[model samples]
Target: MHSSPRSRRIDEHTIRSLPKAEVHVHLEGTFSLLDILTLAKDNGVRLPGPAATLFDITTHDAFTAPAVTSGGGAGAGAAGLSGFLRFLDWQCGLVRTPAQAARVAYAFAARQSASGVRYSDVIVNPTHWNAWHGRELALMDALASGFDEAEQDGLCAVSIAYSLLRSQSAADAEAVVTDLITRRPHRVVALSVDGDEKVTGRTGEKFRAAFARAAQGGLHRTVHAGESSGPEGVWDAVELLQAERIDHGVRAVEDPALLDRLVGGGISLGVCPRSNVTLGISPSWHEHPLRRLHEAGVLVTLNTDDPAPLGTTLEADWAVAAEQFGFDHADLVGFAARSIDASFADPDTKASLHTELASVAASAVDATTTA
Candidate 1:
């Protein structure tokens, strides 16, 4: 019993028009090596390797260098966040000024705009580029300036969560939170706990304190939990530090109780499927638990994590999720709404965005049916 091609057309239209919320994007992860070279040339920084280094987005042989980190031991889990972080090490080297920061920020925003992302919480690693210039304020200002420019261009709205490198002192992480509270970039909305979580098993209480201070200051909290490790890390993020969202909670399936806890708590899991597949989390996209979680009532939001390096876009992620996760119009729209519920924005803004998403999603359905 073949229904019709019209059903397929409607499905594709609905995916494109589904209102979207991108809750986890690393500003450094957004740094494409090609984009890095442009910034380097503008700032006159020397990339130690070949000009070809401009496009190396994967586990690089040049792990310890300036641009990005990669090729870690199997213990560190390269090709996932490690490879992504390595790219940050590279991008931050070239961003030495307020102008440079703004350029990078704007470039990332433009890419987001092209992806049809309506709201984004972009993670910014302060020390990455700031170290090159020896100025923290420049990184902050560049982010602020970038948002200003993007809004004027009618691009999608964007926000920043100043990410503390895992290696940074509690004092340094606190300093960044202090800046967020004091300077208060409207676009810089939250304080994200990023960097390698593996540091905690080896080290001390700085991670705990940094998140506590951020919470005490009324900063919205998100953490990169259970990305590489097991569901225990997810539990640690939920029980120990009180994270609002888990960046990659793929292993939640391993613990049914934890899985139920996430669903019951209404915590959004920023699931990156292709990234999981590329990094070997699951053997293939079809194996991703995003579908399982969504059906199980966990708030699931789709994101690219980083686009250029992964050569992925948010729209592409949605498509894959739709195809792989068996998402229908209602499912994706519900997923979009989940992002709104978990957002750090004020009620009015969140309300407005919600309205916009619904209207757009409705119109998309109408158009699809008509065509």
Candidate 2:
């Protein structure tokens, strides 16, 4: 039965009220356009266009807009994943100082709190931050300091995942792991690798030693695969990199054997449906493989991959699962529970969040019965 407007509103309310955890989100992509405008002015970086008209040009339109190229004019650089990535590099370049980094981190935490995300594993790619090149450790410290303040102020608790670029050399990857092990920057919980897999194909063998070192040093592993490439990349992530979680593993649905492997190995997939649609990975929401993957019993959780540029929020993503994918209240609650389990949070935090989720789930059940 089609849900009434009132029922949809209730569902949205319930999703927003749920204490949630997000496992895949990029800190660099969290900045609002206004945030970018402010940062640009602060740093004296000229935008590709005027601020007032920039919004119309930079916003993404899946059908009409061409893929954004590096150094392209305003609208051209905000359309596809590659273009969105260039925008990330440009906006991140504006944060020249540690204080600016802190400001953005605190703002991210605050936004998460507003959206009912109690905890998030935020990915930080040093390659995006042009100003912080060769000073990644200092950048990490600045981000951690900001998150620490946010946590102390009772905002969402955040953990960092230091990501390696796909194009980086094996030595560069090893150095990142070594730095993480030696310094042990606060709130950094995992090691991840993300870049355009289409541009640099099959790099798992290249970063294997570095990921192994990360494992030996007690860091959790997550890899981006199956988005730009096919199931082969997902296989490398599991077999070669030993990733506990796969980001954008939607393409695994194409290979039943890979689906079996993911399910058997208990690997979690951080599937961002709208992002897939926006980037032309999947043709539309209904065609997206999130439903197929979830039905196959793979541990799947919804996320907003790059919220700001993509124009998404965690709550809105959950709503898509409900309204588009036909996940009911119980299923949504289950996904939320699985997200906490898949997180790199402490056991105590996971347990506590589960308890809180249980309370909200019960209330949701009651409200549904009444409605």
Candidate 3:
């Protein structure tokens, strides 16, 4: 799986040029620091520090700073996944109006387009958005308006995956699903559940009915498991929640049986390497289970779980898979194809992305041979 230095450079170029889809990115965690600062000022929300110093909040240094494990207080010095979640709450709270929500959504699409991501399943959790709690449908409309505009302008096409926090009660989960089914908001394609699974403990039973409702109501289902929890959580996601895709399910490598299940069932894992490393989920890229899962025939798609806050991009993540994880050019291309396949996009869109990727991959091969 090792690539030569010259081949690595070519693979990087190929990765950058490939048409890709990100299946696990969160809208709340995708806000650029500049966007956060601008929204804060525009919405009359004060930052913990001066505007100039706020830029460091998403820098590499900030992740290693003292960990602020819970929400509340100033957000500038926060670190780790918990602190990142708190930052998402604070950042999301700044969108006091639908216009601001639309603006951020458009910015997300623009960012993805710049990274060569032609399509994306952007997760939007109403729980993190303190401002739009009661008016979640309105929030979805605002986000759809922005994404629709972005698509019309020839940016990336986006489908919203409305998320339920894992800490929510079954009733609460059902209520969210009910709203999704009843309102049928524009561009919402999936039902997702995310939060601190470690804090909430095992919640598969709690949300089972909700996920069933989502399935019956015609929404794709994705669950956050095996990052904070273990293989059992992934089992819950598969057996109980019946997840079509698992987000951060890197820990499934720990269980041979679970790996078999994943491989046999064809469930995709939206693996985010930098996010795992940044959050201390896998310690380092060298030790991350993504390679192991890939080797085991489990379908895996590379993603930037939280691009802006983690300070990485989708293309950079693909590069990491090649350089650090020992994936060759062909493997990188396979990853691109897997991303499109694992996405919630319609069959026609998936076919289009695959055809485009095949063309780029063929061009890369021709160039390499001629060189």
lDDT of 3 by residue, 36-127 (tens): 88998898777866566553555434334443332211122224454455566677889989999999999999999988899999988887
Whole-structure CA lDDT of model 2: 0.83
Off by over 4 Å in 3: 3-13, 52-79
Give the worst 10-residue stretch by lDDT in candidate 2.
69-78
- Model 1, 95-116: lDDT tens per residue? 7667777877788878777766
In candidate 1, stretches whose alpha carbon ends up further than 4 angstroms from where it belongs are: 1-14, 46-53, 57-61, 64-84, 130-134, 198-205, 368-371
Q: For all candidates, what are the clash counts?
A: 8, 0, 0
Model 2 misplaced regions, further than 4 Å: 1-10, 53-79
The whole-model lDDT of each prediction reads 0.68, 0.83, 0.83
Give per-residue CA lDDT, model 2, range 1-371, as digits (tens). Answer: 23421124224667878888998888976888778888998988888665664534345332233342221111122244454566667778899999999989999999898888899999898888889999998999999999999999999999999998888899999999999999998888999998878778999999999999999999999999998899999999999999999988999999999999999999999988877887778888877888788889999988888787666788887887677766777878888899998899999999999999999999878987999
Q: In candidate 1, which residue pairs clash?
A: 66-89, 66-90, 67-89, 67-90, 68-86, 68-87, 68-90, 69-86
Let me know the TM-score candidate 3 reaches against the reference structure. 0.92
